[model samples]
Target: MRIAVTGGTGFVGQALVSALLARGDEVWIISRKTAQDRTGQERLHYATWQQLEQNPALLEGTDCIVNLAGESINQRWSAKAKARILNSRTDAAARIAKLVGALRQKPATVVNASGISIYGTSDTKTFDESSPAHINDFLGSVVEQWEESARTIPAERLVLVRVSLVLGNRGGAFPLMSLPYRLFGGGRVGSGRQWMPWIHIEDMTRVLLFCIDNRDIAGPVNACAPQPVTTDQFGRAIGKAMRRPHWFPVPAFLLRTLLGEMSSLLLQGQRVLPAKLQQGGFDFRYPTIESAMENLVGKSSKPSV
Candidate 1:
């Protein structure tokens, strides 16, 4: 199969590309800048989405398309940064919709990235594809709009993965989230009652592939683990994995002062569970926090003290 991935240079994208290649699929990456020739492999190709839109041949014979393009949401949300966050996702989704509309042969499926943040900060309620979106904050609004844009694309199967916090060694949310813990400066943010939905990076990549291969799955699927931990529990788990002492507690006001509105990402969380994936018979590689963290940090290394 030929898969075209937008934002294929990102952390998740890089891993996904490697996974697809291992399974013998041709991968094409769409990025604003030219992709570096690190692999020196012809199976992987790169081009800009604008160029691809101008020339439909770029998408021709493409079996599937994954739209993962978007700006990072971790920074302080200044007015300009907020607009960039919204526009980057919506605009990219719109572009993909247009490309699909113009394609002489539409792809069989389109898997676009959404987020569990669409549910906003909530209690332990488990949300599935049928759950109504919570549009109370900027992150929720961004995800709502992002998914709406992808809905415009007419395809046989449209999948919106409301992904949880992905834990990996290199990038995405893990490095930043675990940094304080590694430094033995970890603690629960705010009340520590908020639920944290997380998935191992490997599981996330596999779930994407599962969605691509399975035609029956569509709509908003929770790309998270079965077990959702509270913020306090998450801190302790990381500390346990790193051999660090989870003692301190960061006050909400301090976090708010430091991160501005972006502090909500840390202060509040959702207990997202992969109900659809489990129901669909997908087995996770690392279902528990302990195993997941061990895989990430390695077994031989001592936990930070």
Candidate 2:
């Protein structure tokens, strides 16, 4: 298999690229710059957006396309930041679609990243692949527009991968999220009862691979774990995994005061389940919070954490 990945240098994209290479799949990484040392890596190649614009044939033989390019939403939600967050996703999707249109042989599968916020924040609601989108906030709207843009791609099978909070130790929100726990200051954020739909980075990458292999699977597939934890439960799990005390609680008002609209990401969440993956017989390596934490933080000891 040959895959073309946008945002290949990002947290999720890097994981996916590594997995693809390990499985002996040729990977073509499309990005803004190509400076990585590709020495001795015959199957790994990088192409800048400028190069792709000049020759779409750079990915001519690509069998699959995974679109994960987007601006990070972790910062303060200033007006400019909001525009960038939204535009980056839609613009990336538009470019992928146009590139696919220009391809001599379009890829059969497109796994475009979406957000679980499309279901809106709900303490009582359980969302699945079949659930209707009930977007309310800025991220939700951005995801809605992002999915719309992805729908324009000329793939025979398009999988709108609605990802939740991916838990990994290397380069994601996990390290920062676990920082307070490592400092023995971990506890619930906001109401503590808000749901935190999540998946381990391992399972997240495998789910994308499953999407490409499973031809029958398409549409808005939630890439979250089966068991959704509350924010309190998540913090407790983190503390336990890191051998720390979950005792420090940050006030919701404080987060809102500091992060503005972005605070909603940590303060509010929906219960999302990977219904399509489960139904399609996709096995998750870390299906539960405890299991995910154990894998990510290690048992009995932490490694360079």
Top candidate by lDDT: 2
Query: Model 2, stretches more than 4 Å misplaced?
Result: 300-305
Q: What CA RMSD would you report for each candidate?
A: 2.5, 1.6
Q: Each model's TM-score, in the order given?
A: 0.96, 0.97
RMSD of 2: 1.6
For this target, which candidate reaches the highest TM-score against the unseen true structure?
2
Q: State each model's CA lDDT, in order.
A: 0.87, 0.90
Native-referenced Cα lDDT, model 2: 0.90
Candidate 2, poorest ten consecutive residues by summed lDDT = 296-305
Please give, for residues 66-149, the per-residue lDDT of candidate 2 as tens digits.
Answer: 999999988899999999999999999999999999999899999999999999989998989888989799999999999999
Residue range 143-228, candidate 1, lDDT tens digits: 99999888998888999999888888778878888899878899887999988889988899999999999988999899988988
